[model samples]
Target: MEKARGVRTERIPLGKLEVGQVLTTTLLDEKGQVLLAKGKQITRPFLERLKARGQEYVLLEILEEVEAVAATEDVPLEVKKKTLEDLQDTLTALSQKKSASIQPLEQDVRRFVKGVRDHREVVIPIIQLKKHDDFTFTHSLNVSVIAVFLGKFLGLGEEEIRLLGLGALLHDLGKLHIPQEILQKSQPLTPEEYRIIEKHPVTALKILDEYAAIGGRIKNVAFEHHEKLDGSGYPRRLFGRDISLLAQITAVADIYEALTSDRPYRKALPLFEVVEYLMGNAGYKLDEKVVTTFVSHISPYQVGDVVRLSSGEEAVVARLNPILPFRPFVRLRIKRPDGTVVLSEEIDLSRSLILTIVGEIELQSQIQVE
Candidate 1:
């Protein structure tokens, strides 16, 4: 269930809705008029009306009583906060052409990657709790965090992976050159404005060259992160062999971060939607191998997420199977009218022929088996 805080919204079947779950997003009719406003508690009559309207499922916010969702907190709060602060300082100094030694910051990023490697989350939110209007630095951190996993999954050597991590952090350094008005504009830009935007990769690369001590491969990301395999990307517009492995890796990370994070223009799309876009655009626009590897690590729902299944049953995600991220192991919550005690049980969604998670929800009561 999504909440007002850092929690993401949960999509759930209408049938599993309790009598009074609070809505997070508004419910609309086919014509787009508001059927139910956000923050309204569900009721018996409301369900009947929705049933008559042929509504199947709804997105509801997490209730107040439920524990704050924490699967995405693999990076400790202290580490995440401090890293963002450090990255901001680093980027600010670089943009201003000040002398900045980023060796310590690079080490911290590598350490964060190692933590991700050990804990192994599937589609967990990165630094979701902390809010910052200036998202560029955190966006860089997210891209690097993601790049580490993708690099490892592709079997890159440790030194290469470390370089990739550093590259991810510095990939967007050029954006600091753009005027804040253009960079943070919430509307479509004119052609002239877009041309300036296209210079970021090259600009970032040059700044890195002048200010920081970084790997040769690390600088490639600043140059080629936006280049498409088909020669459609900007700057030099080099294609195929022209794009380096680290840049290609950074490209995938860059796109995913952009799609998931809130921008000046639009709110972040759902993670599942972003994954679909990546998978759909694999070969021509993005590196097919890298995109596939990153998509494999995304879980449609996080653990501790309560969801409704296709069998008219409700369950909580017990574990995420990396091999089958969508089909996570779930603990089914069975409610029986006979008043018999229901012992808890678990199911591996990948092994079950027909069972699948359809939507996520929050129960009215935080009920659990003792």
Candidate 2:
């Protein structure tokens, strides 16, 4: 495995390490001298935070260092720029159309769909970093981006991805009709008030039905995305095949977006936590197939990202191997007593060791809940 500067170097065992000190561990066969194993040991300080919060694992990443390393590498800047522009334009169009009597931004939606279809991972960070305060618009766009990529991963054709994007963008259109007070409330809603919120899918279906151009599939997706596989979800409690594939995909994407985002009720869960939540709830609350696709496509770490290895060693994600989603080659970003950043040699977490992501630090600003 090729290594980069600032990536992690060792994997430590969580059970053998002290709280404050960083560690490195390996995940190779029992012969530790020959090959490294994949796993990490958590320092007590970080572990205490998780314990206090009644949490098990935390996802940790140093955003600035990761970006610094990535900045020095060659990226398809033109493609990234174009995709971000298209995403911004698409979001703007959706917002405008929702507010007025304008026609659906079909072409803009197409561009958004295409952007996601062509380059998903590269564009996701940009989308997640959007600072817009309009929760409805931004949330819709995020859902669309997630859904399109997921659909493509599921072997759906381009046309399906386009439709999925439209469905996602409009999934919560009915929320526009909700009272501003209830929608933007800072506290949990009363049981009666929560019931009203649950009716949005039905409301959205009614709104979409008015437009003859909106077909049955898209309408169903909008109305059923909240429904679950075990008949535990809202809007008629759909189960199994009763829910369409688009609805299933939307459900997974929507929940993911919602969990990763800040809300009045709570702060966002870290990325690794989000993954664990989904993985834990799969089949019981989520569509296992869709969850698999999501887990497979998204990397736990992006290039240049600084992470706290399971071993407690701080490192950067130098390279990503498509075959291993959990482990990537890393370079150690050792910290000196003087607070200076030092670079160390690289290690392949996947091959040399079985390093796990225990936690992550979310760097983006918390969006105002609405």
Task: Score every model by TM-score.
Answer: 0.70, 0.67
User: What are the per-residue Cα lDDT tens digits for candidate 1 across 117-198?
Assistant: 6664445443343244666777787788778777877889777888888888888899988988998899999999999999
lDDT at 87, model 1: 83
Tens-digit lDDT string for candidate 2 (1-370): 2332232334434343355443333322123332312345445665565456554322232111232222121113343334344444544443345433213445555765565555524223323434335676667767776787788778898888778877887788767767878887889899988898998888888777666777788888889998888999998998888999998898888988888778767887877788899988788878899998787677555666667778777777666655454566678888789999988876766545356555544332222222
Best by lDDT: 1
Task: Return the clash pairs for model 1, or none.
Answer: 2-62, 11-360
- Against the true structure, what is every candidate's RMSD? 14.9, 11.4
Report the number of backbone clashes for model 2: 46
Deviation from truth (RMSD, Å), model 1 = 14.9
For model 1 the local lDDT of residue 367 reads 17
